[model samples]
Target chain A: MSEIATPVQPQRAQRYGLRNYLQMYAVAARQAVIEQLQYPAANMMFMVHILIEPVIYLVVWSSVANSQGGAIGGYTAAEFAGYYIIWTLVRQFNLAIGPQGFHWRIKEGRLAAELLRPVHPLLPDLGYYLGYKIPQTIYWLPMGILLWLLFKPEINPVAWQIAAFPVVLMLAFFVRFFFMWLLGLVCFWTERVDALFELYFAAELLFSGRLVPLEVMPVWAQNVANFLPFQWTFYFPIEVLLGRLDLPEFWPGVLAQLAWIAGGYTLVRLIWKLAVKRFTAVGS
Target chain B: MLRPLKLFGLFARISILNEVQYRANFFMQVLQSSLSLGTGLIVLNVVYSYTDNLGGWSQAELLAVYGVFVLMSGLIGSLVLPNMWAFMEDVREGRLDFTLTKPEDSQVLISVRVVAIWRLVDVLLGIVVLGVAIGRMGLEASWWLAFAFAATLIMGMILLYCVLLLASILSFWFVRVWELMEMMQSIFQAGRWPVGIYPDWLRLGLTYLIPVAFAVTVPAEALTGRLTPELLAGTFVFTLVALFVTRRLWMFGLRNYSGASA
Candidate 1:
């Protein structure tokens, strides 16, 4: 019974630390990249699906601007083009695991297996969605170039704005990621999530400047956007890259994005504690 | 023709029966449609706030366009799209053998198999919007206008069916056509605005490549009293040609389809 003199006693309680989590994210991200890259055709179609939304907005807004004597709420037709073109890229960045995916995971019993893991389910999702950016950006390049050529969009970013673009873009991803994960957690409570998800997306569509730049919206709507995180995900990044924001405005936007990310992360953590407690695995 | 109609009726009844068992989905569809409609109205209002006209379309005219877009979306969603998806799935999973072996025509069988009955909520909603739009425009409904609207709408549906069927036919040769289907649907979003607003290149693509212009805009134009006789004539010819070409392609694709197994 001498514990058979364990061949090599497991190292004294190796704490699952940050380095371990980082390694886990790297592995998960790499897996996501490899998995997404294999479906070139499928990914291209998805890119087209994503691209059409912004393109419609660009076309419609550009037409409105042109029709309205070259500008509306400070965006010229060319600027609208520029905003939504870069929107294509921002969209690629901020794409996250939607609540529908969570509902699917839960209903399919995949969450049961996932709960067996030591880390939160949200961590791997963050990594996977982060890695999803790789193929998405790669697919975005040709489409971006084609859009640029087609629309002849006029984006004028200065040196610092260009440099700050990537940072804000990544921050935007974090903000959206946590919020989306938080929304996904509601699946733990109710299976009837479609109406809720639709409402969330509709809100995002209006407030996020995914439809049009916030400035172009009515003053009241723009004021409403001020309190919502939706704009940080689309409007802030696109404006930053479109060079519409000054440094002072830029810094505050970035700070607000960080604030949302922190708030979303905290909410997810608190809700997740209750959500996990309510979970009853119906499958092995 | 009568036989196909009977077959379609029988399949539609079965689909309706199957769907009624899930009554909650109807409410969900109603909520989703209303939300989208609300967002669409918001977008229109936002756009109208800045300009009285969008690409030569008055706000009321554009509302009519939006109504047609929703109506056509309901038509496709409730009738055409689900069938195409099922057909593609059957092809991918080799279940299409069951259809081909049936006594009825394969095309008719595939076309009328799945009716998403709840999606008709959008249809009713679209009609309501169209009614409001017509009231806003105060268009005197002439008998000719009514005839033209009905005629163009039927043609539009046929043209869309042909185009979508043409797309689904590719599932025979290509395993992953859902992406293509999704892309087409997104492109259809362009029809929400008058195809007139899009750049020339896109206008041509939407009109010819996808026929969304004929499907949504032309009927909308009819309702708005903007449909020219020549455009209506041209649409009629194009619809005929599309149906013929789609029929031929379906036959060709069926021959090429080896099925998932021998």
Candidate 2:
């Protein structure tokens, strides 16, 4: 009697890992850059549009400050310059492509592939999202330098404040993403999402200090902005950078951000569940 | 000219019929326009929260300016822009060839191909707002001022059409000029505020380079009893130049349309 030798079986390929995710991000960034570079004139036009807003706001606020005896609500012309420059940077960072991609995914039935992935559906989406920002960062550099040169902004900050900037900004990004994604998910219920987008934009302009600084708003409006999560998304980080908020104020803002992030995450989870349920039930 | 006018009338009627079929869109448009108007008013409220006047204009006066802006934008959105902008896309896609082959003046056909019927709501809403603002300002609307407003509004329409046509014509050379259009729009949006508030260079650009000031400022000045004869003359001259350049450019673009060597 001879024992038979058993053949060895091969293992299945491992699912995507951190390196794969990094590669996805890199690919997304490269794709974004290529897409942008393909339309040099268009990119230039967008840059000009972006440059115009800050300039308009800066002049408007500067004029306001000037008329009010060289200051309004503690913002002098130079201080206004600092605030707007920082505002511009914060805005550049907080910009997103909205839920258009999600809509596309649903329309094309590509969302199922994302759902099938072992990682969270948002990870790859976030990668693609962050990838688009790479070109934007490059585009913003020259403008930033030009703004600094023109405005000569007095944005002196403590070292700790500088260190905390990126953290606050990342939290701001998540808050915006979750909130907008939740808005996008509403499309599963209704085919049109444009009205919702406009509503969100209008609210954001007022609450996030996009049009004007929260400090300059009426005290009640400022307090309302404090309660809302939008300030955490834009104004808070810029405020931190501008040294308007001290350590005491900074910690509370961070805490508020954490609360908002938790709340946003919960809302997104609930909305995505209901959206997916509605989507599947409708058989799209 | 009569034939084109009749054709345009038919196109407008058909468009109105098409829009009526989509009753939801009409409601949505009203909602959107109201929201947009509300945003403008809110911004004004915020601005006035801190100060009574912005750039020598009171809140009511600024509202008058906004009314002019909205009214002009509505007209552009309704008539001149719809067809002109679509013509650009048609040219890019070689669809303009169909219009060119028609036994009609191509320019007239292209300029009145489609109408945005719902945009009349914006025009009506804007006029109502303007009437209210004018009443609030307590300004006398004299016959001469009304005439000035009429003339300047005509000049503004011509200037804006020229600009849109020029932008569309540029599509012959550059297929992707929509970004240029968007950039122009953003600049025009800034014109919701008076040009005086902007820096010197921007004011010059708005007044002369882009001529956005003609869209709102002249009519606003008319309503405010501040329209001068020189400004009206300047507007007329600007309109004449814009129309001439636009016509020449349209001819040039048409010649190049079929990849013809000229």
Candidate 3:
């Protein structure tokens, strides 16, 4: 039977065209949806865990606002609610599973297979990530509705701002993904990528405006956050969604996001080259 | 008991030898623990910037809470969780049969099977932090408070072990208990703060429903000289109850396993 069976031909080496990428993304998305559906309870619990962070922060800030006579640092209770609710969406969209992927690929010696792929290995990563978000949004939608009911978020964005939001959010995802992917490459050099991941999380907590608003942080921290790309990933889009950033501030934020995406892409490319060299030299 | 202690000592020695093979892991553990400590300190500093007190507790009190939290987590990671995490895998692969056939209490053997060894760094760091926090608060430690703290800490470890054992035993029934464990861990993160900080309903849930309060807050209260007679009594009762319930559950799970196979 083994001798009689003919080996299947390799699939065509398609060029990285827009249509090809879209089909790949669609297939990846379907796979993610199926995998998530297979473990519905686990996915539901994951969604609950995701919502818990935003709820905790919202409660913390709400308490702060209440203590400060229903407003703190120019944010009323309603506005704070809006800020955190939008923050949940932005965070869900921007969070990357890059470190785990990198660690697994490197440890399992599957990075070699990735290097052998005709297309950019990162493309499949991007596709799988984007695909996962489809099911995540399905999970998030009801939670979003629940938050809206409880918090009554006053998220009144202008039509144009609403249109521009997804584009900027996509840019933000790339920024986060590339930076984290670079951090993940550190596993090639050291056995301990966890320390790097921890620092990344710390920076995200402090600078990404997840714990508190950037304006509420100390001015020095705010200034540092302004220079980093972390804020653009979470805080900027959230601000835009909450209509806190007027048109002038909003466009510049988008420009800054674009700049960061370009920079992050360049950095990831350079890191990937170096990481491959180290990986090959070490024969992992 | 003495034999089990000797077995644990042998396990510790083996784990240490295994860890020594990965010399870089020591640095990783140190770096990870330091960063965790730093994050805790930073959060405390940030909260203090807003007010001297958090939820009616002083900054030093909150630090003590974190100290107990870290210490308990280290204990779990060092002994309970490392084994419980593997317990399911052992059950799935029938490797637990080997443990069952051993000339010892299977529960005792299974509970301390895999010591992470490096997690002792967190334990030591937690002790140093707890000491500093106690000194900073200028609280005088009495014999009763020390005794209460020691007892509660031990009970906290036992309670945590029981909870983990119960959670892992569920794996014998359900193959995918990992996500449930993750959810439990996420819920436990809320316990890092004082239960008082949460809304009243949440406080009730943490205290009775999840029992995370007993794991961290009871010991913290002892250290902060805030342990009431009622709270101490409750901790003791809960510890016994949790241990008894988990012991029964483990045997039930084992019987189920055998019944299904037969």
CA RMSD, predictions in order = 4.9, 7.2, 4.3
Ten contiguous residues with the weakest lDDT in model 1 chain A: A1-10
Q: Give the C-alpha miss distance for residue B242 in model 1, angstroms.
A: 1.5
Q: Write the per-residue lDDT of candidate 1 for residues B1-262, one digit (tens) a residue.
A: 6988888889889988999999998888888889989989999999889888988889998999999999989998999999999999999899998889888778988998888899999999999999999999999979999999999999999999998999888888877789989999999998889988888988899989998999999999899888899999999999889988988898898899886756
lDDT leader: 1
Stretches of candidate 3 exceeding 4 Å from the true structure: A1-16, A147-160, A281-284, B1-6, B258-262
Q: Which ten residues in a row have the lowest lDDT in candidate 2 chain A?
A: A1-10
Chain A TM-score, each candidate = 0.94, 0.83, 0.89
Candidates 2 and 3 compared by lDDT, better number: 3
Each candidate's lDDT (Cα)? 0.89, 0.79, 0.79
TM-score each candidate.
0.95, 0.90, 0.91
Q: State candidate 3's TM-score.
A: 0.91
Candidate 3 steric clashes: 0
Interface RMSD of each: 1.1, 1.2, 1.6
Mind giving the per-residue lDDT tens digits that candidate 1 earns over A1-284? Answer: 22222122112344688899899899999999999888899889999999989989898899888987999898888888899999999999999998999999988778877876666778898888888899899999999999999988888899999999999999999999999999999998998888889999999999999999988888888888988999999999999889878988987888899899999999998998888877776633
Order candidates by TM-score, high to low: 1, 3, 2
* B78-112: candidate 3 lDDT, tens digit per residue: 88778988888888777777788778888878887
Model 2's alpha-carbon lDDT is 0.79
